[model samples]
Target chain A: MNKWTKLDNAAIVFPSLAKAKNSTIYRVSAVLKETVLPVRLQQALDITVKRYPMMTMRIHKGLFWRYMEYDDEPLRVKREDDYPCHPLQDRMTMEALLKVFYYQRRISVEVFHAITDGSGAMEFLKTLVYEYLRLLGKAVEPEDKIRTASEDIHPEELEDSFHRYYTPGRPPKIRNTKAYQITGTYFEPYGNNVTQGVVSASALRQIAKKQGATLTEFLLALLMYTIYRQSSQDRKDQRPIKVSVPVNLRQMFPSKTLRNFFAVALFEISSQQEQSLFKILCAIKEQSVKNYSKKVLQEAIVRNINLEKIKIARFIPLPIKDIIVKNRYFLYNDKLRTCTMTNLGRVDLPKTMTPYVDRMEVVFYPTANNPLNCGLCTVNDNMTISFSRTIRENRIIGEYFRYLSQEYGLEVKIYSNEWGISD
Target chain B: MNGGFQINHCIHCQVTVEASLQECPLCGKKLTNTRLSVPRSYPAYALHNKSSYYFQLFWKTLVPLMFIGAFLIPSLITLLTGEGDLWLNRETLGIASAWVLVRYTFLSRMHMGKKFLLQIMNISLALFIFDHVGEARGWSVNYVIPFMLICSTLAMMYIVYKRKRLWSDYAVYVMTLIFLGFLPSFLYLIRVTSLLWPSAAAAGFAIVSLIAVYFFLDKNFRSYFNRRLHF
Candidate 1:
């Protein structure tokens, strides 16, 4: 018999809204210096799977709720033949929520959001690369952060940290107001077109410091400014241009759980106000400094957990709960913000393994309504900013990178998934 | 126990081993006694037991209790009212059959063909019981069930046609539908049902569908059959 566990608080919304267009899946890939050997990769994955027990489970249906059970099926590593962030067909596959695919020197791990968040997925990817390097006869010593296959999986890694950190209090509700939305023609065959911009980490940091804002604040301001400039003018209704930024709670709270322990911070700027770049950056910096504070994030966490703790919500059956959750998510996506921007922050690896690995990138899938999303991660001073969009128009992505090169005087190497839109 | 060293290290990987071991787990390097004591880099923590008792209780105890109560409560109410008849018994059985149907549809982790077959059987059984208990009318065996079987077979065929690449995956399901399509004629022949048109219509449609696919879509049909039958 296999073991089973209840779905975590953050994961409860993903299973209901999972579809082709809105897969809620993300990818983190590591580019190695040598070509990937499939046999060695499979061997490494077999060993690594034992270390991450939570990643080996499958979602199961229960009487009042959906739970996850350990799936004993063998996981297979495949070649990358499909588009990035394709929906995980658990029923068709081995019932695993995450998949490993390799192409040339790159090894990618795509995980359904129901399993884990970006930070947790990155941990898995890092450990996988560690194991892969070891299998390849590379002298990869285990580091402080990397959990090797020989070590026992920690209890904290499997815990639902949200439940542990949730405090019962009357926290002010986050507003759900409509923001300026981007409209465009969707790509054919319903695929995500990823445009990755690789820039120098020190140079980007210098620019951020010069603007008197952090990298995240600077990027948020640029994203909002780009949207504000591109959005069509509707004289009757003027809404604020907003971007949803996911904050990793592990930094604020003392928890090492691999499950989702993150909160989203919505940053908005008035579209009607004619503001310069400096004014926008100042506004973003002020709001972000206040929002990213511990007190504000704790309030956000309390407000989110309070929804799950409602008396009526606890007793409601799974089917009804799914409907309620889906409706809440739909409303959140439609009215809460224009788009999402998630920063995985700097990823550090063991010194011994650095020679074998090149760099890393993170790609987030877009929702049906919000057709574009941005994910950023820095590895070995190579900051890769990935834009994943389902829309045909790449003007925003083009302009964003162009702004970095032309205005900011920073060299940005740009590439794309090349979805081949004839238009 | 040499006085020169208190630590064991792998000669190949050059990493210190925390536990007593004969070989290095990472590179199969033989352990050797070393003079320097190196601290273990990994944390000392027991692996968390993955078993969840709450999930076990919900699935093993609560779900079965709910399944039983769905039938038991209604029957108990019917009996306690002192207005019991064959109707209550039939209703209880119908509810139980409906529960089985729903359980197989949503809960059972069976293949698509097995689920479809189970659904067909459950629906037919429920209709048979209802027809027998209500008025002994042959409408269930006569028109309803045969029509349902033929319509479902057509739907499955249409689905297979639409998903041409997955025709092999649905071949067994289509074959099962064809086998079920012949079942209504058996009922008619056994004198359990008096209606001949419905059975003939269902069987005829199944035969025609089989012939059409085999003749018109010969290449796909042969490929699907060969792959599904493992020939």
Candidate 2:
């Protein structure tokens, strides 16, 4: 129940991706030094999880609004022995784990954006690895560490579970995003398989700057353009390509819990015209950041969180809540635009656990119902872009990475559950 | 709603654009400031600007029907051992068949959700009766039977259309009737069948049709598909 109180942190950003409904869980795997966890890292995770237990909370009721607070429950960790990694066949070598279970060599954690954004999850992962390394007596320093400080908890902050983090207002009106690509529909496979690829963070940023775009703008543009190119080639008609981007509501609203705190915004580009890389990047950046002002985001936060609180307090039986949540899937399916590209910008770790820790990799596997899965994770100066799909579209993924390298001058190193080029 | 106004500068290219313009409009950098006194509006009734629906009917009907078939086939098998009425059988099969035809015949014609629902209902009635008659005689309304009816009715529906009548508009109303009529059948199918084929098929149909309709009907699907598919 106190999970809502954890949203008070400035770094808790989660993006909801309805792209793949059945494969909703996203996982980030890190190999920890087999020693005991550093006290600081362990404490940080304990604090982070306890503060936002909603992240670990499951839907006890309601279909679309399926959020429940589980405070007294202990964090469930699965041993690698219980859940082994199942690798896939093909260029995208993905390994799917059943769920998050920690064992001797590796630990895998599954997270849903309804709880937190990519950035927020990366923050947890960095701290976890840092602490794990420190426990083994490894000296570490984050090359891209922005700032260092002691426990800088804002004292006056009350443990109000529903405090607004962003400016307040109404949810932005939903827009009917027209699909611009033509492709057959397919479902995500049931097994848990994941593929990870990493690029130097500084290298990506430098590419973006060189192209006169921000890192996100450049990345999104590369993806949109690539998908557009691949999907359009086999048909006579050309539709606009849409890329769904998850927006972190925490920065725009004021909730401190680790529940579903995100919204989706779409970036569209037409293949009919001579596509301009710079222009497309600019357009995506505009749509992603500008469509909803801070006030608008704030209003949505207050309205959504308040509605949940009211529903819970009204005692609308659990069965009724379940029905409501199920129906919501249909509503969300239509209202949300297509595809997903989640960016978990930069991660931070404690001072004591830096040296032994290398970089990190993050992959997002949307619920099985989604069309495509995209996730970006950064640690130190490296970023890994991972994508998963129930149906295979190697061409789409291939074209996407190719465009990233060709257009932005950023060399993309490819990796998969099947094939990967090691650095 | 910050007075619907604000100032913004593109993070890159230093391009300045008024809040009214979505992109930089110059260097094309996305502007963070979207607030403005006057909200930017598309052409009044942007929906009106949609292209005429022609081949869109083929896509719409084909998409949804394919899914209905995927589900109906498996569910029919399960229903053989389970308990259900002839009316349910005919109704579901009839609806499914009619839906494919109706989609081919009407959904492209109509743009309204309510109207489409109505069209689905119309087709379900006939399909219901036809399916039950066959079921009561112990003949399953699977594979060839439903497919034949749907394809025939759809082709016939178009035949009835006068040269002046647009295929898209008429298909809309037809689709509505079929959807409304077959909805119950679909539900029954879901209940009696654990196989997710119908759900998958229906979802697949919607998704494929969604893209097809966008390009074929609204965006001139064939042209768009050809242009995009080629390169």
Candidate 3:
């Protein structure tokens, strides 16, 4: 709430107008060698809440106007041994053991985009799981560096390591004039708030590397081709598509408040003609990497923040100011072409906790307000690009994943509730 | 100017008094002299068709007027039969007192004057109808017949105000029933009442003419009255 915290969170991002209501999921399944007490999970949540207090609350307002807090009780974990278990955690079922349910097992942590990005929340979750194990008397080494470190680290040092591991490729040349419509589709059976998880970080990186594409590019290509394929089957007008890719602006700006800290870079692909599975994926990868550079992200951040500062500087009241800004934002949206493709980088857990944990999977469900739902998942040297069919058709999600494993020579595994029959 | 109507000031109160008044009604003030001045309107809010206005007119105006007339009509008949002093002193004083109250309450507001007259005509006609119908059947007019007519009219008025439906919807039905049932009273009022024109038939036509003019008049009568009737 202070000036410094507000500046850190200024880059908070939303999906294109089309996918505004969408929420991404980051679900990790770890095999605890020993039983972990629920008390340990609560303690870990208490510690995390003390640190990043924004991740511990639910969205309170309507479809928009989101804020965050750490006041709510922590999210709960379910034990499979309990009869008639929650349908959400059925995949991570265990026969015998103590289940760690933080702040009572019935709570949920629904984060609005204004608060924290998926990467930030994933980090919080990783630390939480790690701390829970330590509380259970399991051999655990604490994360000393991040705990002691202040959030005022330099942006160059942060991106330097990222650049070393993954080369900052040229961003894609997006071509579109109209904005993508943002929307969401709610499934009653997803149990409170759940998104279908797929893709592993390693698998996507390897596939993206093989295709001479970055992980984001490969995913964007997959999304564009899948949508192109789906729309073409219906014999609809073959229109050029655009997807919104969120850019983290935490370092470029000078703060690390857990509130919104992201800008957006769009990736556009022309669907002038039908493209082969591999061809579209390659194009997507090239364009996405090119669009997601340091210069591009920084420019986007500066342009938006300056506009916001100028807008608020006007003497109009907050509500009227918000309306004018929103109307202007809408006017610019007509140039956008298609959907959204978000790629949260490799979810990293503590070095010492690898033995106790296996992998993490993230699933994204855009709101019914948005017409598209493409989720990215990366875990244990493999990646799965899962798309939800609640809004559009299932064939698009099915064919896209199928072609990734089939045509690309990538070993991809597809999992759904009731084998593609979303129940 | 000297022959025209003059307003007077009350001797005791020094308040501007009406030209017609011989004594001040307020503060027991007495009038000293008369002078010609414009008669200021009585500051009264009058709604002719509203239930409260109609009810007040009925209780304070119509009922008293009709009851006074009831005693006077029979007394006039008795006087015509050469019994002039038969109704004097006690009954004459009562009827006179009732008539004075009726005129002051109902005829004070100009907006309510026409509607009140029409209501009186309707009630008189209803009584005539009951009398005629009973005489034709060789039976005397029963108490229940007149009582029912009064009750029904009051009830219909109550409903009209309560529902707030358009006047054209249900107002026609109620008016039609009253007109059909009040034939004899129409004849009687016309024959006896000198100030109300010669006959009930003529009075009825005049009433209808007034109603048409009031509803269809291009002028805003409410605004006109509001201006002229300022306190």
Candidate with top TM-score is: 1
For model 1, what is the C-alpha lDDT against the true structure? Answer: 0.75
lDDT of 1 by residue, B21-125 (tens): 344333334556523233221112111211223444566578768867876776787778866564667767776787677667775566666688788888888
lDDT of each: 0.75, 0.47, 0.44
> By lDDT, who's the top model here?
1
True contacts kept of each: 0.00, 0.00, 0.00
Q: Tell me which of candidates 1 and 2 scores higher on DockQ.
A: 1
> DockQ, per-model, please?
0.02, 0.01, 0.01
The better-scoring model by lDDT among 1 and 2 is: 1
TM-score of chain B of 1: 0.66
TM-score of chain A of each: 0.96, 0.70, 0.68
Residue B132 of model 3: what lDDT?
Answer: 55
Ranking under lDDT, best-scoring first?
Answer: 1, 2, 3
User: Who wins the DockQ comparison?
Assistant: 1
The interface RMSD values of the models, given in order, are 21.9, 25.7, 46.3
Chain A TM-score for predicted structure 3: 0.68
Tell me which of candidates 1 and 3 scores higher on lDDT: 1
Q: Model 3 interface RMSD, in angstroms?
A: 46.3
